[model samples]
Target: MAGVLIGLALLAFWLFSLFDVITAPEEEVRNVPKALWVLIVVLIPLLGGLIWMLRGRPKVVRDPWPVPPGPGMPKGPDDDPDFLRDLDRRMRGED
Candidate 1:
């Protein structure tokens, strides 16, 4: 009946939550030691999920993806090939 269905639903939900805690990425779960995190999540299921998602959201950077260059590290020479090519073209035209 309705009671049985509700019990199964709750059990399924509980299992899903436990599985998520167990299998969560090490880095994510490592933020809170697994034992403590599991207890907190069990006590505040909605809050735990929200906190995890918010904190784990990947940061996006507008700069080139593979890590930006260090400060003062010029990306290219002032006289890089493209600049030299343009300079040569300008000189040829002028001459």
Candidate 2:
């Protein structure tokens, strides 16, 4: 019973690792190439998953700087003078 449970757990882990390797962006993967990682995960299952977990996973990179607002972006209609002017004109029934 315990052996069967262990085997099932390994199978799940292998499948999860295989999918992660395939779906991960090429530039993000580390160590061996993505193609080789796929083969290793497919061919060796348990050992392959262990190897990937240990060596092939990518480290996530986070952007430290805040993104600047794009051109002509307004925080809100109330805060934008042009938008408020347009709203006033519209309210007065002027096209």
Q: Which predicted model would earn the best TM-score?
A: 2
How badly does each model clash, as a count of residue pairs? 0, 0
Which consecutive 10 residues in model 1 have the weakest lDDT in total?
52-61
lDDT of 2: 0.90
* TM-score for candidate 2: 0.61
Per-residue accuracy of model 2 over 1-95 as CA lDDT, tens digit each: 99999989988898899999999889988998999999999999989989998899898778767766567777667878998999999999999
Per-residue lDDT of model 1, residues 1-95, tens digit only: 99999878766666666567767655545456766666766787666655544553223437666776688665666636776778888989964
Clash pairs, model 2 backbone: none
**Candidate 1 — number of clashing residue pairs?**
0
Error of 1 at 42 (Å): 5.3
